[model samples]
Target chain A: MGLVPRVVVDVMPKPEILDPQGKAVLGALPRLGFSGVTEVRQGKRFELQVEGEVTEAVLADVHRMAEMLLSNPVIENFEVRVEETA
Target chain B: MGLVPRVVVDVMPKPEILDPQGKAVLGALPRLGFSGVTEVRQGKRFELQVEGEVTEAVLADVHRMAEMLLSNPVIENFEVRVEETA
Candidate 1:
């Protein structure tokens, strides 16, 4: 087996949507003595090791997967980053 | 009110720990026609907008926060990236 393709998918809630987890963190920052922390947004990151080259086709497939399963398009947005692991 | 610092905190389960979410994603990939997806690791990313400069002291404080509140040291590892939002 050769080196695999690595991809990172960052999925975050849309700015207009309310992020309760982020809000909770923001609320607790000051209590934790992290007063400088003004805002916080919690999100998901998926590191995918694909069994192939990091070609355009692979990147497209990954993007499709991110949209279809990794995130909810209505209230969230996602970014796909293709890395050269080989 | 100068430029603020943007910090991205990434928290992921240690390699030895069980990641049921990642496993579920890996298992579903093939069925979803994503045969090339060999492995998947799901993690959390915290995007924090700090109300100060991205100084060394600020980075250190962020690291402390990550170790104490952002992640469970026994089960996961975390990374912190300091960015300029100026």
Candidate 2:
């Protein structure tokens, strides 16, 4: 069997969507003396240990998975990065 | 003034921490026809639009911010990547 690959998927809320979490962080930054942080958007990241190789087909499958499970298609956008960790 | 830099920070739960969200995704994958996904770890990503250049000092500042506010240092780890967007 081929070595399993590691995948990192980042899911972010759409620019127009309201992100309370992000806003909360932005609010807290200045208190921590992290000034000049104009804006912040909080999102989700999924790190997957897959039972297969990193291939175009596998990436497509993962993308589908992201669209179907990892993110809300209407309000979120996701990016998939595949790595051959094994 | 230097161009604003976009910084991406990824925060992940410690390997041993129990991640209910990750478990939820793993469970839902198969039902969505995405089999062979042995494991999944759910985490958070922060996209920051900073009013500064992407420099080492800026990265270090972001790292400090991550430790102080972006993550639970006791059970989470974070990485910061900076990119020039202007």
Q: Which portions of model 2 miss their true places by more than 4 Å?
A: A1-4, B1-4, B84-86
Query: Model 1 TM-score?
Result: 0.91
For every prediction, compared with the true complex, DockQ reads 0.85, 0.88
Q: Model 1: DockQ against the native?
A: 0.85
Candidate 2 chain A, which ten residues in sequence have the lowest lDDT sum? A50-59
The residue-by-residue lDDT of candidate 1 on B50-76, one tens digit each, is: 765777888899899999888899999
- Residue lDDT tens for model 2, B1-86: 55656899999999989999999999988877788788999999999987646677778988999999999999999989875656
Q: With candidate 1 superimposed using the best TM-score fit, by how many Å does residue B42's alpha carbon deviate from the native?
A: 0.3
Report the C-alpha lDDT of model 2 over A1-86, residue by residue, as the tens digit: 45556899999999999999999999999888888788999999999987646778878889999988899999999999976655
Task: Give the lDDT of residue B39 in candidate 2.
Answer: 92
lDDT (10s digit) by residue, model 1, range A1-86: 55555799999999899999999988887788887888899999899987647778888999989988899999999999976655
| Per-residue lDDT of A81 in model 2 | 94
Candidate 1 A-chain TM? 0.89
Best by DockQ: 2
